[model samples]
Target: MRKKLKEKISEALSSVLPITVIVLLLSFTLAPMPIGTLLLFLLGAAMLIVGMGFFSLGADMAMMPIGEQMGRKLGGRWKLIAVAVICFLIGAMVTIAEPDLQVLARQVPAVPDAVIILAVAAGVGVFLVVSMLRTRFNLPLGPTLIALYTGVFLLSIFVPNAFLAVAFDSGGVTTGPITVPFLMALGTGMASIKGRDEDNFGMVALCSVGPILAVMLLGLCYQSTEVSYTPFAIPSVFDSQDVGAQFLQGLPDYMKEVALGLLPIILFFAVFQLASIRLKRRAVIKIIVGIGYTYVGLVLFLTGANIGFMPAGYYLGTTLAALPQYWMLVPIGMVVGYFIVAAEPAVHVLNRQVEDVTSGAIPQKAIGLALSIGVAVSIGLAMLRVCLGIPIYYLLVPGYAVALLLTRCVPRIFTAIAFDSGGVASGPMTATFLLPLTMGACEALGRDILTDAFGVVAMVAMTPLITIQLLGLIYQRKIRRTRDVTQAEEREIEFVDEIIDYNEEVEL
Candidate 1:
């Protein structure tokens, strides 16, 4: 156990260290902040690394197993309606558990946070029902996604522009750290009963769609107004002691937040254990310990992200935009984006599951690289929008169109994984750091934060659909070529053997 925990922390160090280095470089060269702020940022990075490490381990221990067990129960001979209702409840409850959703909920100005969160949860529940039914009935994911997203765009017409961006961004944030492992594992459990690779992958994809549709509908009901965003306040600290005090002050709030976020899941699992799925006592204890790890990890991670990273991202963005060479935002953002996706806790969950689901036919490394490139492009585009004020629809409409188009072009399993990657790529890290960065830049440039800076997560979500599918195309072509070569060699060997056999017969 100690070895495994050490390994998890080590993996997190590698994942987080590059982004930290980049931020340090930026601080020293292009976007210097006060030494106190930099020190806070460094402390936050350290906490982030440790928190993610423990969180990843906890997910493996608790969330994945719970999801798999629940999925097994779901695979029973329940009526379709029963399954749908259960799935809806699970989907809604699990979404509310996501810390990333809370982060996003705070940013949108006019809507009550509870209203937005509940609406998004309802959307997830409904779509998760669809996902389960589709799996049970053997439906094609591509057509279903196309139909739903088509409706999404149609609904976007009625939504206020500010709300539209938030609506789309909500899709990305919904499938965050707490939700990803469970959803992915649920898909795996379903597949274990009676499913293919595609079945093991598309739950997250389907669930991601629910929030966008729900939020857009909510926007239609609500009145539009000029939304105001208060940018991050740079910290003022005299000494290192004050910085420690700041983190200590923030820790209790996050502990309570994490506790509340986890309570539903723990209670639900308890009920589930007593009612439907009983496990060994030892297993239950392990899960309990894992939950403890998750709580501790999340509290640390949130405290760091909210207190340390937010201000740094804000200052960096504002300082860079204030420069004469503001075009540097695009290139700098691209670099940051490339490395940042690796640091996302949900991303590692997806990558691990993808590799495990495919039995390493698709590697973790390949998924990581594809996701990095996709996020890099997305962030660059997002920064460009901040500088030039491009409406998000201009990019999202065509981007999703192409993504939906590729659903038909690539292998179906890859399509599932690709869409799932879109959601995974835009987890807590994107919401916490990248969104703040864009918001800061928008504030500095006097752009509308709602319309201009809000949809960066959506952009982060969209590009992976295309890039991973493109990777799939490459994978398919390679397989075809290898098959052709093997067939050719087999034919040649058969001809040569026939020749030898004929000669031996003649000699006999």
Candidate 2:
């Protein structure tokens, strides 16, 4: 356990250190921030490192097992209606508790936070049922995604344009840190019983869809024209004591929030364990420890992110965008996007799972690089849109069209991984940091926040669908080449044997 904790901390540091360095460099060179803000950012980075370490370990120890056990048991004996209800409850519970969803809910001005949260949660519940049914019936994922997304776009036309980006962003943030590990494990457990390799993935991808559709419908109903944008206030701290006080002040609220977020999951596990799971006492004890770790980690993580990184992101975006050379936003955003995705804890979880599931054929290093490149391109495009005031649909429609087109060209497993990667890439960092950065830039540019600044997550989510599928295309080609080479070698060996036999017959 100590070794695992140490390893997770090391991974967290490596993941976070790059982004921290980048932010510091920007503060010093390009967008100089106050000393207090810088200190707060550094302190936040420390908490993030520690928090991610504990959180990753907790998810592996507790959430994954619970999800897997439930999936295996449910897949075997539960009636369809029962399965649907349980899945809905699980989806709604986890989503409501998702930190990313809460962050987004706070950002949107038109609807009450509870309304957005509930709407998004209910959406996830419905789609989770759809995803489970798809896995059980062995339905084609590509056609289903195409049809669903087609419906989403069609619905978007009637919904307020301002809400379109928010609707899509909902999908990306729904499959965040808390949701991904459990849902992915659940899919794996369910797929194991279904006797299909590809079914283990695409559950996150499908579940992500529910929020977009639900939010779009909600947008139509709410029909609010004005969105209020409130920027994070940069902290004023003159000393180390002040930084300590700031973090300490904010810590308890997040602690309570995280605890409330975790309670439902713990209770659900307990009820299910008593009713059907009946896990061993030793296992239950381990999970209890894990839940404790998860609680502490999330509190620290959210506190650090909200207090430290949020202001830095907003300040940096505003300062950079306000520069005479405002065009620098594109490249700078691209660079930040490249590294920030690596910092997202959920991205680490998804990459590790993908590597494990593919038995290292799809290497973690490869997935990381592909995701970075995809996110970089997406951020560049997002900054461009923010700068130029382009409609998001202009990029999204073509992007999804190409992603769906590639579905026919790659293996189904890769398709599933690609789509799931899209959701994973746009986790907490995008919601807490990138979204604020975009909003800041839009505010500086005097553009409509609702339309211009709202879709960074959607863009982050969209590009991975194409890039990973492109990686899949490459994988398929390599597989075909290897097969051809092996066949050629076999034929050559047969031809050599035939010559040897002919020579022997001639001698006879």
Candidate 3:
């Protein structure tokens, strides 16, 4: 246990340090922030590192096992209806508990929080069913995605323009820290039952689609023109004590929210344990401990992010945009985006999973680099949109269309990884930090928040589809080159052997 804790802490520090350095550099340079804000951000960074360490450890200990066992047991059941219903319920329940989704829900003003939350949850539920069916029936994922996204775009056409970015952002946020570990493990568990390699992936990818469709449909039903965004309020702190007080004040509220979010999952697991799992007493005790760790870690993480980092991001964006060379926002955002993705806890989970599933064929380093580049480009583009006032659809339509087209050229596993990476890349940090940053910049540039600032998550989600698949194309090329060399070597050896045999015959 001590070893695992140490390892997680080390990983968390490494993951978080790059972004911390980047933010500090910005604060000291082009985007000079208030000293109080800087202090708060530094404190928040500490909490984030520790929180991520505990959360990752707890997820390994508890969330993965719970999800895998549930999926395995449920997948084996003969009753399709029962399996579908249970999967749907689990999907909806976990999504409702997602911290990232909650953050996004609070930001969008046109729809009530509950209405958007329920709608997004329902989307997850329905799509989870579709994912299960796809796995069971061996449906082609590429085509299904094409069809689903086609429908998404079709629906977008009818929905209010303001809701377009929000709808897509809903999809990205739903598959966050809490949702990824469980859902990925569940997919793995179900795939194990099927004994197919490809089945394990694309669960998160499919599940992501649910919220987009659901939120878009909701937009059509409840169109509101009064879309407004509340900017992040910079906390005033005169001294260290005030800074401490700020975090302390926010801590309890987040603790309560995290507890409420986790309660449903714990209760569901308990019922599952009683009904089906019957895990050993020792195992159950371990999971309970893990749950406690997860709860504490999440509270700290959310408190630090919302109370500390968010305001810093907002302030930074506004400060940078107000500069004479406001175009610097693009390169500055790109650099931040590159490093910021490393701060996403769920991203680490997804990278580890991809590595394990591929037996290290796809290294975690490669995944990390690919995602970082993708997010960098996404954020750069997002800033460009905010600076120049470009419609999101102008970017999104071509982006998705290109992503769908690439599905034909790349290996299936890359497609799954790419799409899944999209969801994983846009975790809590994106919602809490980048979205606020974009909103601040948008406000500074005198652009509409709903139309301009709303799509950062979606942009984060979209670019990985192209980048990872591009990685896939490169990977495929390497494989082919290796194969060709091996084949040529074999042919040369055969030729040599034939010549030797003829000489032997002549000598004889």
Q: By the lDDT metric, which is better: model 1 or model 2?
A: 1
* Residue-level lDDT tens digits of model 1 in 46-85: 9999999899899999989988888877876877788888
Q: Point out where model 1 deviates above 4 Å.
A: 103-111, 505-508
lDDT of each: 0.87, 0.87, 0.87
Query: Model 3, 1-508: lDDT tens per residue?
Result: 9899889989999988998998888888888878898989999999999899899988888888888888888778659998889888998998888766776677567779898899889889999999999988888778899999998898788988877887888889788777887888888888888887667788999999998987777777777654556656777787899999999998988888778777767887898899988999999999999998888778878888887888888998898889999999999899999998988888888888888888999999998999999999999999999999999999999999999999989998899889888888988899778988998998888988889989999999999999999999999999999999999999999999999999999999
RMSD each, Å? 1.6, 1.5, 1.4
**Candidate 2: deviation at residue 418, Å?**
1.2
Error of 1 at 115 (Å): 3.0
Off by over 4 Å in 2: 106-112
Against the hidden true structure, what lDDT does model 2 obtain? Answer: 0.87
lDDT (C-alpha) at residue 39 in model 3? 87
Q: Candidate 3: where is the Cα deviation over 4 Å?
A: 106-112
- Give the C-alpha lDDT of model 3: 0.87
